[model samples]
Target chain A: MNEQLAFTIEVFLNGLMAGVLYALVALGFVLIYKASGIFNYAQGVMALFAAMTLVGIQNGQVPFAHLINAIFGTDVHKFGWHVHSFAAILLTVIVMIALAWMVQQFVFKHLVGQEPIILFMATIGLAYFLEGVADLMWGSELKALNVCASEGNCLPQGMNVWLEGTTYEALGYGFFIDNLDIVASIVAAVLVAGLVIFAQYTKQGRAMRAVADDHQAALSVGVSLNFIWVLVWSLAGFVALVAGIMWGAKSGVQFSLSLIALKALPVLMLGGFTSIPGAIIGGLIIGVGEKLFEFLIGAPFLGGATENWFAYMLALVFLVFRPQGLFGEKIIERV
Target chain B: MLDDAKQADAQVDNVLEVNNIEVIYNHVILVLKGVSLNVPKGGITALLGGNGAGKTTTLKAISGLLASERGEVTKGSIKYRGQDIQHADPAETVKQGVVQVMEGRHCFEHLTIEENLMTGAYTRTDGNAAIAADLELVYNYFPRLKERRKSQAGYTSGGEQQMCAVGRALMSKPETILLDEPSMGLAPQLVEQIFDIVKSINEQEGVTFLLAEQNTNVALRFAHYGYILESGRVVMDGPAKDLRENQDVKEFYLGMSDEGRKSFRDVRSYRRRKRWLS
Candidate 1:
């Protein structure tokens, strides 16, 4: 292949890889939305919270060290020991589960039967609350998450080292790709498969889907609504944590980690709020579409920020023809 | 007939009982006005009423779905198998062997017919083998459901949805089912077919039922006993035969009188006419 065409293919592959990350976050949204009718805008912040908590626990940093030092002029900062990565991850999972339980107890439990738009807005409030708590707990500093499957900070790197030696030498061009992206993509695929199996086969999964279909019917059939809601929220939290770890390691754990949640909004609009497969497929489409657009048009012509609005514009146009989304059930109106 | 006559003389052993229940909706709107009724063990009893006559509200009260809608029985009591269940959650009520097949046939539209049926047995810890047996039993009653077992409930017609709803309720193995408007919005033939299935389920499975309906014609035909509600009060009640023969019920409810297709063989019609005359 020619140089330009090879470059284009590389960009396209990178776009698809980015799409996998979007799908990770979108899965969190889909899980919570499907089970509880909660369009959780807090999902991104939940990820941020998880990532911050994971790093703080790993590094043996005192919770609220900065706030304590500022308030009391204390010299205390570190706990003087480090937690193993596996231990920190387990602890983070516990924290996420506890957070899920608390969120249900405090925020969502009282808001049952509220409108979807209202729930969505409530989640936005929850996002702010979670962000504040995360900042208070972890001092809100940029932290490098270090729990990679292989090497170089949370994921394997230097995948292009091999490509440059053999495949690229034959073609007079090397395909540059991050092993982290490839690893993240595999983790996402595994996460989605696990979720699908849980939803399709397990009793609890069926109960969750039943709750989604008809709350009253599910209740009458003897599935406790509150229990199912908690289970769903915790599952979403775990998903958010996975997303957090991946994104945090990529960009350094910071406030911007939560903005990736915004990138997922167009994915939801395209995929439909209640669909799992839709979230994945929608994420992929948005991921690839934005990348290709930026490469072919934005960088060369309309400026480099077309990636900011391309997904949204595409979702808007698609929804005009199919309002329920690509895989969402077509809504049937009854008088 | 003899047993029903004995039931008319006194309460013939009820599996579920509602006594003078007053319900309020949204803390202000009073919906059920001291309503009372009984379901004879292993028999079908129909509660007949017009729209807004509190039939659905009464079922919601018994099933514990009212609270989710902000409706609560603020007065009186409901007993299932001699246990007070007025404040029980809907899931609790289901576990206690009383399930309500809700009005409007709220089948899980996204679920296949079989999955919807399986959900009805969600609370049961009984072996899968028995649950499977009960599922086949449900399919036998509503064979159309078995034919469309894999089809999504949303795409099915109204009659099939109703059948699926009832079949789902049966998966719980409930002793008493509070059926709300099973005959609503269906062809006359389908209505009769549904009632026939209900009757057989009552007879063969030995399941008791308290069905609230507006169709007095079909309800009275299949029900062993009938209670007529008007504006949330139990205005009239008797064994099905006596209720069918009553003058006021014949005219106002069934829309039949002496001149209609209904026979006036009973000489008591004159005395009943005098009661209306005064």
Candidate 2:
């Protein structure tokens, strides 16, 4: 193998790693979109809030710690709750679910029957509001999260078997892979598979599909729209929590985690807004295609950071060919 | 009409009674103006009218769909089984055994035929076993629906969709079924078939029916009683047999000319006077 080929392989693997993270965020988008027509622009912020809440509860923050102790009547700090990572994750998930319920019951319930664009704008407002609430709760400080894997640390780097017998060694270039990248890949694949099965086989999943098809029809059939909304939002919150943990472990949890959600917009556009499998495949394509393009075509002309626009450009190309999306149903209009 | 009203008032077993109801749309335009009717138990009643003549509006008002929105029974009351249900929700209406097979056969297009049938049983608290039994009954009435049970409603033909719609309403096991334009847009053969199934459903299930239809001839043939609406008001109403034999109805609706009416009257009186002489 040549130096060029080895570098190309490295870029491709890196793209796959990034795609996994994008898939997680995109999952959240798809979940909310399935149950309610609103595109939840606040999904990224929900992840940020969940991560911040986890840190706050672990650190014994003024209000959260006081409130928890007052309600449960147990001194969390004295009981040594801060030392338990699993407990913190569980508590953060619960708080996120409660927040989801509140959001549906108060904000969304009032805004029902509004136009989809108006609802989208409302979600944007929710995003900003949630970001503010998170900052107030956790002071916008950076925090570290432990990996959920029992291995206790990211996967270690090892020698590539394909590159072992290659002459690329002469150029000090070889296919490199990180332990954390490999684990992230595995986790992403598992999550995607789990979600696919859940949506396909479960009763709640069927209700979600029905609601996505026609909300008014679903309501007429007695599929409690409010309850489904809260359920989907909480499910999205769980996805966000997982995304937060993984991203927090990789880059540390901060406001920047919210920025990662912007990546999912192009993912949604490329895959079509309402598709679950489309999100996963789109994430992978955006992930690997961008990195390879950046290395092969982009580096020679526009320099680095070409990966940032590569997904959007590919998505733009797809829109021209199949406007509804790769997996989306074509919309027909009748007079 | 006042004497008929007095007679209906004396009857205690009225299935549904609509008294001088007014439905206004968008708080401005009146759709149903002082509309009133009564359906007797175990009989088919027809609401006949031309397009946009408040026929469909009346059906929706009784089914609780219109009452929830821009429609208000401002002037009168609706009693179903002696219960005031003017303000009832659709779910509550279904619970009270009143189901409407709405205009256009509003089947859930994306759902499977079987799933659409299950939705009709939404208000039922019975377990899966009873629902399955009802499903079998619906399938028996519309065998075409049974054949396409796993197919999405959108893929079904229009007549088949109508069957699924009516079948779904029956799955709820309602005492009264309101069908709006079940014969609309269907082939002539399918129209006859649908009306026949409706008649059987009435006879076998003892289900009271209030059907709104544009085809006055077919509606009168199947209905036990009928109301003829012209421009949002009932112009004439009586037993279906009497309406079929009425001379005014023949001239205006049945396409009978003056010569045909005169000959028919002469033949009828000649037969009567001959019988008196004998």
Candidate 3:
């Protein structure tokens, strides 16, 4: 490819990678929303919390150490012992599970049977509460995630090197691609496939679908509603953690890390809130579409940073024409 | 083992007994005022009433699904195999071989016909072979379901949806099935087809049934015994033959009375008259 074409292709590929990250977060929203009918605005913060906890545990940083020092005027910071990446990830998983349990027990248990709007508002409150809690537990600072290290840094150079050597050499120009994006693409593919299998083949997965279909019917058929809700939230938590690791490693762990979750909202609206594959395909569309728009029109006409609003516009237009979304179940209204 | 032995003792003669149960919805609205009924083993009993007669509530109460609707059996005992199950979870009720096909044919519309049937066997810990065999059994009774097994339940017709509901319940291999309004909103021919299937299931499978319906004529044809409820109270109940012939039932429920109807409506202080008692 020529220089301009190579750049465009690079932008498209990068956009696709960004879309995968969005889909990862969107999957959590779909899982919780489908099972519990709670549009969890806290899903993004769950990712932030997971990444923060992973960093804290990995570096032997005491939770609320900063707060403790501020309150008592002490100089204590670290616990003086470092935990490995694998151990940190495991510990983070446990923390996320515990968080899921506590959320169900404290926040949602009392709000059962409430309208979807009320639950949606509750999740917004939960988002703020979780963000605050995460900040207090681990100091509100940008923490770099050192996991998934390829060579010295996680930005995979191999794909770029390979493209430069072979494919790009043929075109007299190389398309730049981040190895992190390549890794994320692989992780995303596996995660989605694993989720599909887990849903299709597992008993718990079947129960989740049943709960999603009709709560009262599922209850009558010997499916425990509360248990299924907890299971779904925990599964969403695990998805959030994987997303946290990938995003945190890509862009350092911070409150802004949670902002990536906002990217998923349009993806969800585009894909339909309840469909899993919609989340995936919707993610890819938003990713590639935004990049292409920015390169072709956004930068020249609107100056830049068009990726922010382009997705929401696309979703809005799509919804106006097709309210059911690309793959969402057709809603039948009975008067 | 002990619980199983106790339940086995309760399981004889009558598969289910709802005794003097008073159900209250939202902690205030009285729905079932001291309603009592028995579902004999391997016998089909129909609870007949118009809308707001608490038939669905009674079914929900027996199936332990009252909690979902903020309804509770404030004063009553629902026994399954002679054990008090009023306070048990809905899931626990199903686990003990009692399944309810809910009103409005609440099939998992998103699921295929076959998947919906498989969901009925969700509570069973039985071997896959037996579950597969039961799937075939359900298919035999409702061959329409077998042909449309891969089709989504939502897209199916109302009669098929009702059949899917019953078929799903049969997949559980329950000792007793609570079917609410099996004839609602279906063509008369389809309603008769469903009733025939219910009767066949009762005779062939020996499954006890407590079906609630407003169509007195069709329900009476298949049901061995019938109860007539008005305003949450069972005013009269008897063998289907006797109830079918009674003048009051014939006039009020079945909408057929040879006697002139004008004088009966014009009677003074008629609320005091117990025509059946007289």
Candidate 4:
């Protein structure tokens, strides 16, 4: 294959990898939205905090003798837990769940029947608080993670399979697809499927749907608002933990990991806030589509960083045609 | 005929007894001030009042919706089937077979008619087959809903939506249904049709009804017992027939002249008391 075409394919593959991560973050947003009708601005921070907590529990901070002596009167990094990646992941999930429960019991429960804007602002407050807590708990340093499977080896390492007298490379050029990426993709797909089944078939799923449809009607039917809120938040927290593990494994766990949540906004915008399938499909489209666009057309004109705004632009264009979303129901206004 | 008469007489026992419930909203404003009423096991009891006279508040208190926001039933108890249900959750109340068809029909507009009906059986732990059977029974009462079963409730006309709401409530298999303003915002023809359906529901299905209504003429005509609420107080209480003929009821509600009031009272009271005793 020619160099130009290879580069295009390479960018496309890379975009798909990043898109999967974005979709993971977006899934967290969708779960919380479905149950509580609030767009959680803190979701990104939840992901960051989970990632940081995992790092802190797995590998202790760098030895700074003066600061450690000043703070704990000893070298604290030497007394680190050094837990396994898998165990750390599980522990992080538990911590996230506890945080979720606390958020619902303390913040959300009191804010019931408040205006939507007020609730949204409260999530913004939660985001800042969580970010500060994460920094204080783990320090503001980046920590690298060992891949759950293996480090320094992509899934398919430069294998070419011949088909019909032509040799087609299994992996793209210049950017080898890591087995970890493939695993992340598979995990994301499985999570999405599980969430879909839970939302459709389970009794709690029906209650969640009822709550999403109308809060007053759900309350009238005797659905506990506080319980459902906590359930959804915990579910969202699990999603954050999963996303944190994958992203932390791929790119070092740090405060910047929270920035990934910003990408999910456009995903939500394109898919509509209430849809689960919308999040998955919209994620894949943004992932695969933007990379290809950036590699081929973007380099020729707009230069680089096309992937940054590609999803938002596509979503904006789509909004002009279908304002609610590709999958969103059209809202009718009654005077 | 004798057995049926005996059964009817036994069923006349009070199914619901409300004893002096006082409801305060936002902890200060008293909506229901020591109000009490009783509904028999197998007929209509009309709660008649003007707007804001606590008719809707009384119905809501029974359903558990009004109590969610700390709207304390300060002074009395509500007995359903001889058990205190004043503090029961809405779902528990529904499961106990006392379903409230809320005012304005509160149909789940985004849901299909069939889905709306399914929600009524939300608290039922019965098998899907039993639920399906109940659905058929509900559709039999309001066939129009069955025809538009797959259609979203938002698209249905006002009268059809009312039918769907009532039909959905019936899907729960409640022994007693509380209806709040079932006649509101409908044409006179549709109102007559709804009242006729309510009568059939009571007569044929043996379901009891406590209906709150503003149309005093029609309410008194259809009800077996009636209470006239004026400014959150029951000013007059008697059998429906007696209330229809009472001088006070005629002047305040029936729009009858005062010249005929004095002569009607004794005859009306005696006839009403005789019907009650029989």
| Per-model DockQ | 0.54, 0.20, 0.48, 0.24
Candidate 4 chain A lDDT trough over 10 residues, lowest sum: A158-167
True contacts kept of each: 0.68, 0.13, 0.55, 0.12
Predicted candidate 3 versus true structure: per-residue lDDT over A1-335, tens digit per residue: 46787788778888999899999999999999888889999899999999999999988998999789989999888989878777788999999889888888898877777788999999999999999999999989898888747322334566444422322333676666767778788988998999889887777887788889898888888888878888888989999999999999888999998787788989999998999998989999998999999999999999989988999999999889978779786764433
Q: Can you write out model 1's per-residue Cα lDDT over A1-335, one digit (the tens) per residue?
A: 79899899888888988998899899999998887878899999999999999999998999988789999999888999888777889999999999989998988877777788988898999999999999998887688887654233322477434322322333777887766687789989999999999988888888888898889888877889888988999999999999998888778899999999999999988998888999999999999999999999999999799999999999899889877788785665433
Residue lDDT tens for model 4, B136-230 = 99988898888999887878888998998788788788898889999999999999999999999999999999999999989998988888786
Q: What is the C-alpha lDDT profile of model 1 across B144-214, one tens digit per residue?
A: 99999998888899999999999999999998888999988989999999999999998899888899998
Ranking by DockQ: 1, 3, 4, 2
Model 1: lDDT of residue B17:
91
Off by over 4 Å in 2: A1-3, A58-80, A83-94, A147-203, A330-335, B1-11, B15-20, B24-29, B66-79, B82-88, B228-237, B243-278
Off by over 4 Å in 1: A64-76, A149-170, A332-335, B4-12, B259-278
- Among these predictions, the greatest TM-score belongs to 1
Clashes of 3: 2
lDDT (C-alpha) at residue B30 in model 1: 88
Task: Rank candidates by lDDT, best first.
Answer: 1, 3, 4, 2
Deviating ranges (above 4 Å) for candidate 4: A52-99, A132-140, A151-175, A285-303, A306-323, A332-335, B1-15, B27-29, B67-87, B126-129, B203-206, B247-278
Candidate models: Cα lDDT each: 0.87, 0.78, 0.86, 0.79
TM-scores of the candidates are 0.91, 0.80, 0.90, 0.79
Q: Candidate 1 chain B: minimum summed lDDT over ten consecutive residues — where?
A: B262-271
